[model samples]
Target: MQSRRKLRFRLIVSFALFGFGLSALFAFAALNIRTRVEDQLVNASLMDDAKWANQQAREHPGAPSGSRLLTGTVLSDRTLYKAPLTWQSLENGVHDIFEPGPDGEEHHYKLAVYREGGIISFLQYDVSREELGKQQLLFSVIGAVFLFGLLSLAIGLWLSRKVLKPVSELANRLRDFRKAGKAEPLAPHFADDEVGELAHALDEYSARLTAMVERDREFNSDVSHELRTPLAVIASTTELLQGSPDLTEKLSERLKRIERASRQATELIEALLLLSRAERRGPTRGETTEVGKVAADVIESQRPQMRGKPLSIELAVNAPVSVNAPASVLSVALTNLIGNAIKYTLEGSVRVEVGDGRIEVIDTGPGIKPEDAERLFQRGVRGEGAGGSGAGLGLAIVRRLCELYGWDVSMRPRTDANGAIASIRFS
Candidate 1:
């Protein structure tokens, strides 16, 4: 497609070429008219001189007649009659007999003679009206071209803008429709040409995409619902086995590990379901939830999991902070960050800091490498030196929930002598 600048340039060039051709034609006609006028002037002058000379010679026989004397004197001037008369000269003069005579190309003359007591004289002069007419014609053509070109250009630009306005509006509407996860309908302007046809096709495509997304969402929801009952039964049976007294130490340890793994799988499945919900719609409707309270609750719930670890957990919540967000989503995200911090730091401490609309989880574990930091929150991607047996969905879930709630998440090396810090900023 041609850009606006290129289209304007093409139109200007076309108009200029057309104007130049017209100007050239006018100039040619003007030159032809001038040539014809010069020839007629020359012929008439010669005829008048001949008649005057003959009348003078018939009236006066001895002394030279006034007309004869005048003609002879004029022709004798070498500067005035530069070229001698020849066949070539006569033919050239006759061709333009109705056109402006040439000045430098050929010299014109007046001649007089007496024959049978009759004085005959011939006179010639060049006409220059053709050159003046050419000038006038050129000026008129130029003025007309400028006036018409400007008017046409103005009208063309106006029409182009009017015609393209509908397309521009439709583009903006389609962008909004996509962002809202809705189907875009054909724009009203799509009632005519190829652009209109394209708009209709886009509307059809968007409808299909919306339907496919809806189906995928329903499928994810159904699967999540079906798995909940089985997972709940398994969790309950594992708890029962752990409480029994007949188990040997080795068997008990193995069963405990299985129970932990099963619990982790259940948590991961729940996170996946939440993510699917967030993707299909958006963040859950927000309520005024106390951030500090949520943080304290998550810490208390996960305390048992850190019992034998050679690490300390610290909570440094300053002022009471509140935010409008889903309480469960925020709690889940904070729990994952704190868990990772505890799992990674072997012999140091993990700190959870809560402030105005913000939470930071810092751990004294081996700090993340620069390359690893970039992909830390990506699903199924574990950083080097991360704890073994981690599902790697913790940070991924945190990142997705933050997006759904319009929060910001960032990670950096902690300044305090040990690990990495993950920060979440709520808007």
Candidate 2:
């Protein structure tokens, strides 16, 4: 994957490339213009000098002399025959010529030929000096292009810092708010600009979010408080009824079920309250709960759910396991895990193992897909065979409880059996 470049760095590179391209373009045009103009002027001067020398020779009828940079030759009927065959039929225009000089090296020159009145004239001008000047001009333009690019880069850096200063300040302020777990009015700290508008929007969002969280906290508290009152009454009433004498065996068993349900509801409320607050409920000072005892209790509470299915629930205490949390918290977590196992298993056994600072509930039931192991823990998600009455929040609540207390919970399909294994590692 390609990594993203920051906006500030992009701007700097754009400036540098634009400067280099424009400078190169201008240099190219200037060089073309200079070369064309110099050639035109040189051609005109050569042609005019050739014509003048021809006329002077015609009027005076004598040989002419020339300077080091220029030479003119007037050829008449008699002298034309002495000229080389190549020069005899030359046209009347500027033509480039290369000839061997006294040093046996090639020399470059421009020949302007003129013909009129039985006389042809040639003016030759050396252009090697002009070529040297063109080379120097090309080097100078190249240097200027690089210089302009560097200057543009410097300017871009300075402008970028100034332009992004407000944005950086806003980001820093938002970071501070996050660390402090509270938000302040961002607009008050910024000037009236785009950044300030952004800050105002963030402030509004933070206010709405805070208000919504406060309402949720209050709602959970109110619900838990009201629910506890009725649950307490039911528990107290059941206890009183249990003290009655002359109770039949069947009646006593029914009462025990009611009592167990009432206590389960109370524990469920406590767990839900803890989840709502997203806080840990540590065991009381100098207290710890044994994992095996909690697991056995949770299994017994959930066994009533089998409803006469050909399913058996078993608990295996592999080793002495304990955790630094209230039994109610552990009960809530284990209840959900073991309850799901027993509910899903149709005819086979559900085994609960407590050891090694963890508990594993393995059941022979309709196994889960490996891909959906984590998804099952999400709220509003249900397994394939889930009953219509299920809200799918059991595993979600369990996951939340585990996270609150720094426990690790996971579900996976059993390798040797057609069922699932769920484990919670308390570390």
Best by lDDT: 2
Model 1 residue runs over 4 Å out of place are 1-142, 161-193, 235-271, 279-309, 369-375, 378-381, 387-393
Candidate 1: tens digits of C-alpha lDDT, residues 1-427? 9556754456556555565566566666766776678657655555555566556555654545344323331122223244344311242112223322344454334332222231223333333444556577667766766666666566566665676667676778778876986654774556677778888888788778778978989998788778877877877887898889897888777766666556555655665776876642333464477878878777766666677878788888877677766566677788788877777777778888888768889888988876677599999987666457777777888899888778898788867576999899988
Instruction: Provide the RMSD of all predictions against the true structure, rounded to 1 decimal.
Output: 9.5, 3.6
Clashing pairs in 2: none
Tens-place lDDT per residue, model 2, 287-398, is 8899999888887777778977998888999998989888888888888899888878888899998888889999999989999999999999888763535889989989
For model 1 the local lDDT of residue 420 reads 94
- Once fitted onto the true fold, the runs of candidate 2 whose alpha carbons sit more than 4 angstroms away are 32-69, 72-126, 386-389
Once model 1 is optimally superposed onto the true structure by TM-score, how far is the C-alpha of residue 252 displaced, in angstroms? 10
| TM-score (C-alpha, index-matched) for candidate 2 | 0.84
Worst 10 residues of 1 by lDDT: 87-96
Report the CA-based lDDT of candidate 2 relative to the real structure.
0.86
Q: What's the residue-level lDDT of 302 in candidate 2?
A: 79
